[model samples]
Target: MAELIGPRLYSCCNCRNHVSFHDDIISKAFQGKNGRAFLFSHAMNVVTGPKEDRTLLTGLHTVADVYCGDCREVLGWKYERAYEPSQKYKEGKFILEKSKIVKENW
Candidate 1:
């Protein structure tokens, strides 16, 4: 019998809690506060903080900080609203800092 495999995942670097799947990534070319980031269509095992408007490299956007549910570590942010039409695609998506996450089940 063939051995089964699990989905590749991204985990919180601080706690190793599963946060996202590799297949859910939308873009890898993103910038975060520390360094590189990734855009993901969905994230799990996370908590969103209060929403606030912030000016980013893209533009002004309503975003909420996302934390690791297990450890409460600040992982990144979720795009609640985008002011610019071109940036609207990011709405409801998640940005996870590369420095804050680790690969799992690879």
Candidate 2:
């Protein structure tokens, strides 16, 4: 069985609430060789769905999928550039701010 790596809060597809959460962890190097410059190889499944989707076509546009634990809301997402150079990935360029949180009154 795969180990839980990354308690990422995500919203349940069946329900709009964001209680359903999963951990995403990638220890391998997912750059250059991996499809699309670099990607989170090991835990790619966690962020990406099995089947590709329309518009995105691939449905693997997710760099990071942050869901809410309380309301199961799709809090935020981080997209990645496939097969690009590693330098393209700016350090500390990605972040999840406190403002992204949607506090419900209920």
Candidate 3:
């Protein structure tokens, strides 16, 4: 029989709390406040802080900080709104910094 396999996931580096599934990743090429980041279509076990307007490399956007639900460690940010029409596809997506997350079940 084939062995059962679990979903590949990314966990918080500080607390090992599952944050996102590998399948949910939309893009691996992104920049975070600390370093490299990944764009995910969905994130789990995380908390989003207050929304704020910030000017990024692409343009102005409304975003909220994302933290680990278990440890409260800052992971990245979620795109709340994109002012530029070209960047609208990122709305509602989550960004998780590579430095803040570790791979699991890979």
lDDT to native, each model: 0.98, 0.31, 0.97
Alpha carbon lDDT at 46, candidate 3 = 98
Q: Residue by residue across 40-98, what tens digits does model 3's lDDT show?
A: 99999999999999998899999999999999999999999999999999999999999
lDDT of 2 by residue, 1-106 (tens): 9675544543333343533223322221332211222122121112321222212323233244434444444433344432234433422122222333222222
What is residue 8's positional error in candidate 3, in angstroms?
A: 0.5
| 1 or 2, greater by lDDT | 1
> lDDT winner among the candidates?
1
Worst 10 residues of 1 by lDDT: 2-11
Relative to the true structure, candidate 3 has a C-alpha RMSD (angstroms) of 0.9
Flag regions of model 2 displaced more than 4 Å. 1-64, 79-81, 86-99, 102-106
Per-residue lDDT value at 22 in model 1: 100
